[model samples]
Target: MKKFMNEAGSLAADSLDGFVGAHDDLVAFGQDRKHVRRRVLSPGKVAIIAGGGAGHEPMHVGFIGKGMLDAACTGHVFTSPTPDQILGAIRETDNGAGVLLIVKNYDGDLMNFEMAAEMAVSDGGHRIETLIVNDDIAVERTARGTGRRGVAGTLVVEKIVGAAAEAGLDLFSLKAVGESAIAATRTMGVALKGATVPQTTRETFVLGETEMEVGVGIHGEPGRSRQDIADAATIASLICRQILDDLEPAQGQRILLFVNGLGATPPSELYLMFGLARRFFEAHGLVVCRKLVGTYATSLDMAGMSITVTLLDDASLGLWDAPVHSAALHW
Candidate 1:
């Protein structure tokens, strides 16, 4: 019930206004509060567009800069952006090389972005490609049911594919690289406390002083189950096991490990998680090529952390190592 914002106003516009004001060099405000940022539109290189709810800051918009996304659409907190907003971003970012929509696997996001893509094609004959990220291993897998959800691993996919596009890769080749990165990435999360949305002046979920939720989503959705609070090593072990079970990284393979904080979790806790994750990877004979630790992707005010691992080959590693300058992440 503790928040510091007016709850009876337009959350989306207010948030975007502040974001654009602070990062004018990296981003600009577009119609309908969309985020328009300059991108490297090399001839024959496909444009990249990504977006979703507003709480996951520095995600779609934070990534809009050199060697990353071309533009981003910002919806209300915990809600999907409308088709028109998404279409506007596509139109603004498109430079005749076609556009690629990087969508999360949430139901609302999938439906809305697909509708926007269809509209873009029907109205302007702009070729649009899409890559849906679904790397959360905590969710169920069924052909006819809601598959895995996209979590922290999405940033890695976007980073790799963005580099490919920046290097003037064609749409087909970028799609291939994107799909490969998506397939190789996996994520799992743990929540120590719940988050409060600005619109709702209350916590989304409840947790006792000595309990935690494993495999929690970024939007405060219920995770696998609650468990007694344990030490950081034990918690990291549990999360890493789930991700390793899903990905099965080989002994000699190089991997990118990301320890992401879900808003309120401090950097110290994230570093503790990273230490344990590094041990686990080393014990399994996996070569840790690079590691990124911070609140790259986050929930509103959720006190938790998520881990993402991407198996890397030479080409994937090269793309990931490319220089990237964005509002949230800099490399």
Candidate 2:
């Protein structure tokens, strides 16, 4: 709760204002600060919009720019954006090729984005499609009763889908590409420490110095189990096993290995985990063709990291390599 904010009620708005001000050349606030969009819109291109709760910085918002998301609607900390906010983004960004909404598979996010899509078609006369990303393999379908939560693998979906949209792909085509990417991706995370919400002083969960939360969710949801903390190699092996077992890629499959820090982890440790994870995947007969390591998706200073395994083909690899200019990712 030691956040640098004047008040809890205005935390989201104030943060948005600062972010917009800093990246004024790259992005601008959507109607009434409901969302953030690329300052220079690409007319006639299929608009790619992604959004979810805040706290996971440089995510939906940071990915908004050339060759990526055209607009990103954000909710309050760890809260889903309203349907009205989503609809406004669609209406404002949709040029002529329609829009594609890249949503994570959280209950609030799914419902709100779906409602906005319906509204856009019926009320605004805009063609809209939605791609839901549920890449977290931490829980079985029965665990949360909402299927696996979308975790860090969302970055892979957004980048590939965004490139496709920027390349003039139609709404349906973009949806197909995004769906395939979703099908090929899987993610799992571990938490060394829980995050403290801006509104409260208590951490999301308490852990002893020697303990860790395995397969934790971005919103601090409980993972499969909590156990004694192990070394990086041991931890990386367990996580890699979960992801590879779920994804089930063929032998020699070229893959993109992404190591994402959950808010508080540092780059030095991130790279160490990445190195270990890469070695583990390579041992399983998978080719570590492309890799990304950074604090892309986070949970409000939670000390942990998630590993994402994405099976990549030539087309998808090209899309991932395509030019992108955003606050968090660029190439």
Candidate 3:
């Protein structure tokens, strides 16, 4: 309810315009400015396009730059972009080489992006392959009947896949890398409080000061349980354990540890949780080889965090360390 906007319904469009204005050197707006693409599209490069709702900033958009997404479709708050909008992005980026669609596993995103792919090919016969990210260990299915929710792990896939694209990998090989990244990554999150979408008058969900929702998805879908909040270490244990046990990688394996704040949680707290996660790995013989910590993915002003673990071999580790320059991440 309390948002700093002149109007409500136009949040996505208005915010995207402001973003283009602020980071014009890094990204450019499509005809309507609703679609975002890299300022300079590489002709021979395999364009990586991704989209979803708008509440989660710096995702799908912030990652739009060199070594990340080539184009991103911005939708209304928690709503999928129309086929036409995605089609606009696809046409803007494709240049001889094919385009890869990196979609999160959600009903709206799945359906809309698929329709957009068909429209893109139908419009001009461009080749497009879509990869669905379903790395969340939160639940097998949500109310929308999608597979597992795609949470923070999607970022790693974007980075690795983007790096592969930049390495001049063909579309088919790039998609294989993306799928491998998705399979190797796992994510879990807990919400101490719910987010209030800019378009909505009420918070997405209500939580008591001393309560928490475990296994939360990015869009504030109901998690597996709502119970009294626990300490930071305890919280890290439960979430990290579930992720590690489910992954069950070989002992002494190296991995990337990404800890993300929902929206309002501070770096101090996120790092605290990150430290606890490292400790857990150390005690269990897993190596915390490379790590990215901060608010890479988030809900709108929600006070919580998610921890993502990606098992890394030489190939993924090299791609993970590949230089990246984007609004949210820069190296």
Candidate 4:
């Protein structure tokens, strides 16, 4: 129940104010307080914009900079930004080439971003394209009617495709690269504890000290099951198995492994999880082409980790290795 600020009534402008002051070099708070996009500009190149809720820090906004997202719109915690906010970002970041929206496959995000795109095209006369990322294998067979949900793996797609856009790739090519990256990525996560929304002042879910929630989504949605907490190695194996099964990377296939912290999981634990993931890949005959382990994407202070494996070819690998200078992620 302990929290610092009021989530419901706390204006998005207040949050952006603190963020911009803290990282002036990395971001510039837009004139419209509701819209916060990356300040870095790339003339003659297509701009990339993506965003959703606020709690997923360093995501849509943090990725804004030289090599990642051109702009990002932040909504309230766990809620999608309004269409107006998204449209403002498009108008600000769009150059003559075009603007691409990297939307996660959530109902609100999809709908709101789509509406903004339509508005941008019809009213603003801007060329707009959209790509939806749904890489979470945990919800691959969701009973909620839809298939998989987008989770931490979205960071991978944004990084890869953002690089392509920065490299002067056209809108069509950028969209193709984004879709390819999403298609090649698969993710699985386990939650140790629930996160407290700023406004609620209480944890989203109750879990016994010895229990863990497997197959969790970022929004504190109920996971597939609750089970007794196991060793780090065992947890990593479970996550890796799901990712491998869904991705089905062949022997000798080069891949990128991301051990992402949900929010509060320590780096020490993440490294341990990475070790288990490495062993799993080695056993499966898959080569770890590149590895990134950290809290790249998180769900507030939720204690959990998600592993994303991107099956990569030369093009994808090159795109991934491209230099990126962002607030949350660099190089």
Q: Can you write out model 2's per-residue Cα lDDT over 1-331, one digit (the tens) per residue? A: 6777888767777888898899998999998989999999998999999999988987889999999999999999999999999999998999989999999999999999999999999998999999889999987877646798898999999999999988989999999999999999999999999988887767999899999999999999999999999999999999999988888889999999999999999999999999999999999999999999999999988999999999999999999999999988989
lDDT score for residue 191 of model 2 = 99
Worst 10 residues of 2 by lDDT: 139-148
Tens-digit lDDT string for candidate 1 (61-112):
8888788887888788888888998899888778788898999999999999
CA shift at 279, candidate 4, in angstroms? 1.5
Record all residue pairs in model 4 with backbone atoms less than 3 Å apart, i.e. clashing. Answer: 7-199
Say which candidate scores most in TM-score.
2
- lDDT per model, in order? 0.86, 0.93, 0.89, 0.86
What's the TM for model 3?
0.97
Candidate 1 error regions (>4 Å): 39-44
The true-versus-predicted C-alpha distance at residue 40 of model 1, in Å, is 7.9
Model 2: residues with Cα > 4 Å off, grouped in runs:
none
- Each candidate: RMSD: 1.5, 1.2, 1.5, 1.6
Q: 174-223, model 3: which lDDT tens digit per residue? A: 99999899989999999998998766677889998899999998889888
Order by TM-score, highest first: 2, 3, 1, 4
